[model samples]
Target: MPFDDFAHNPRTLLHIAGALRNRGVSPLELFRRVGVPPSALLDANGWVPRQLCFALSEEAGIVSGDRFLISKIGASFELVDFGPWGRTIAGARSVGEACAVAANNVELLHQGSALRFFTFARHAELRFEYHGRLGASPHQHLLGSMVFLRKIALLAKVPEAVSVRLSIPYSHGAECLEETCGPRLEFGCDYDSIVIDRSILDASIGDVGPNPIEVAETAEATGALLKRLLPYGRANLETVAAHLRVSARTVQRRLRDWGFSFEEILDDVRRTEATRHVISGENSAIEIAFLLGYSDPAHFTRAFRRWTGMPPRDYARAFRSNYS
Candidate 1:
């Protein structure tokens, strides 16, 4: 797949980066190894190669004993693109109807993640399984998956989830995990899963007051916007403007109205992805630097230090220590 086609959402990348940082991998080094320029981390509209993304995950697995990339990039869930889909679910007459919509049409929004709903008379369960081989840094994927599911449930207004499960092993932040999972999370399970009361699935969504046609149009517009901004991992303002057949000034103004600059969004993407690679401990810092397009390891090192306060080696060591 083209690097830019991977749907460059910075928030997703940020979650990945934060996971790696927590595990002791320098974000800059990870970016460098992945062939992403350090500057890209700051370019809100920048994109990175999909191969590099996979590589980061693979390397993390080797170094960190976790395969987060598979769950993160391989899995399909997106909040930005979910505007219409969420509205559709929100407009559903009942919980089962909403879930049916999610089951049948999630592909209309995202293709990477799978949603399975098991409805029994008394209880209902929703299991989101990420398809594909596990990446080196799966913890980032796990965390992101959890967060995404929680958000979905919250948006759907499920009264409460009975439990949440993760396939990856436990980490240091139990308290934080509980806070994120809402006091009913069960970690270290066979699969990443969530259990909800069946009654919630029957509850009416009420009116969200959005037109389905307008929502669909908005989704299409957003997809087109992402395509232009992320074009195959080459995210320069000029390039983006050219792709959109618009002037650079117009693009800048549009982004400004969104309360972000292209540069800021791109940087966020790079840093976020770098963190995921670093934490997974699957790739060498040198390799990651090269993958990210940094010719000089020293430059990568300096940047990594700035991003995570430690060199790549130290970061990897710390991550292994905590998890192993």
Candidate 2:
């Protein structure tokens, strides 16, 4: 995958840096070890490298000499730390509603993983599964998530009397697990999950004072605008901003903070659609060019060459001849 696809919100890294600083560990040194620049932490809307985020969390455990460093950080994490998504979660009426919001919109915070929520006879489970292996980082990811889930449950004001257990796929030394997360750790489990009392699911967290319908509408609109150029569309920053009732410059700066550019996203869309059109053999180069919004066939050819290292005709020929 392209590095851009691996991007995630920078707040994750910023929070980790704050945690490391509190422990007297230099986050700069950790970033250096992981090959990420120190300046990346400053961008409020910036996306930190996905690999580096995991590496930093893993390194924090090693450098701080705390086996549960990730859990500590996650436990301390506040809903507001998640920005708008956190507010959406905070406004949810019940634990299940909150988990649903987090599970559905997790990619808005980090594109690396998927979250699932389930309810059984006596337990409500929140599960985390990454899209791919992160080498030694799953330990951190799983442990951090264990604490993060517990924190969210607590935020729902679930009673202390409720029983909660954590099931993890890895065995992280039983003593350390118990010492850090209490006696409810179940190792060698089928997944990383948080199990809480099912009764807590309906426990009201109170009205959070925002209209859920309005919040959902706003989130959907922003998501649609950001993804407008994908698959097939011609949308630039100015056009998108106009649609969103915002200034083009404001859109540009916000996109910058999110680790994307109007041009780059448009290019990605074109590159993807162009490749598909070529491979499918459904459109001539000129037709594809016109469909892709190019005025000149020659200009489209040049762009296609830049995208694929070959002319469109050659690429199509190679693709069809192989399958035929």
Candidate 3:
């Protein structure tokens, strides 16, 4: 399949790229192997193709010579590692509130994944629905959920021993899962969930100091950006302002305050999208030009050169040579 079918947060891939880069791996080669364009990392609100996520995970395992690399990487993720979404969770009043926020907004982290919260008299469970691609391992999903829940507990100052337990769908030797997470690993379970003591639910968040106002401001800025890119191909000022239910002057003023302009945002998105399409080794410059709203091939060629300091053909060649 081509790289355009499924989309996900590009942050994970950026993290993987950084890790691999530190280990003397060529980032371009990694992107080539995964059929992702390197430019996808620049736009924080942008999504990369999901196939790239799977390929990067598989390649990370192969390169590191560690079959458990997925879990290891996921376990090492910090609360701040999740960007704005993590801050939103951290800004909540309590652990339970954070869990609810995460549950409600998991799509901001990963598009196809779901986090469900269930509360009982004694405990609460955070269940994860990975919705991973066929034949892809679910270890990353499991460990990520565990680490996220553990961080929540830690942030809330809950005792480690009795506060949280983990249940996973697959049995990866009780000892291994126990070591990756903590002691309480229930393998061979129907769902991947983290069990937490309900008593800790109301505990005030202690160490992870967060500013709710910052979170809201960030969200507002992000929403404006998303609004500009809605339908992607149509990125005019009037349309975006209407979509945001505001006047064009207001939208312009707000984005200007944030050091943004509609033309700049549209051009950035087109550049990113154009790079992805070109690197797939499927579309020609002419096809991609039209696909990205450029009616004139010469105009697109100039814009791409301005964005990348090279012609699209040359850029595509460099990307292809990485894998070849």
Which candidate wins on lDDT? 2
For each candidate in turn, the TM-score is 0.48, 0.58, 0.61
Residue range 244-271, candidate 2, lDDT tens digits: 7878776665544333345654565566
Q: What's the lDDT for all of these models? A: 0.54, 0.65, 0.64
Model 2 residue pairs with clashes: 45-257
Which is the better candidate, 1 or 3, if ranked by lDDT? 3
lDDT by residue (1-324, candidate 1, tens digit) is: 322444332223433443454566655566566765434423334444434555555565445555443344323344433454555666667766766676666554333456777787786666776455433344554565565665555545654645677776676755456555667777778777667677566566554433433222322233344434442445567766676676778766555433345665455454545566788778777766665546676876887887678987887789789889
Poorly placed runs, candidate 3 (over 4 Å): 1-6, 132-135, 159-179, 209-324
Query: Which regions in candidate 2 have their CA more than 4 angstroms from the true location?
Result: 1-4, 133-136, 159-173, 178-180, 206-324
| Residues forming the 10-long window of minimal summed lDDT in candidate 1 | 212-221
The numbered model that scores best in TM-score is 3
Compare candidates 1 and 2 on lDDT and give the better one: 2
Q: Count the backbone clashes (under 3 Å) in each candidate.
A: 50, 1, 0
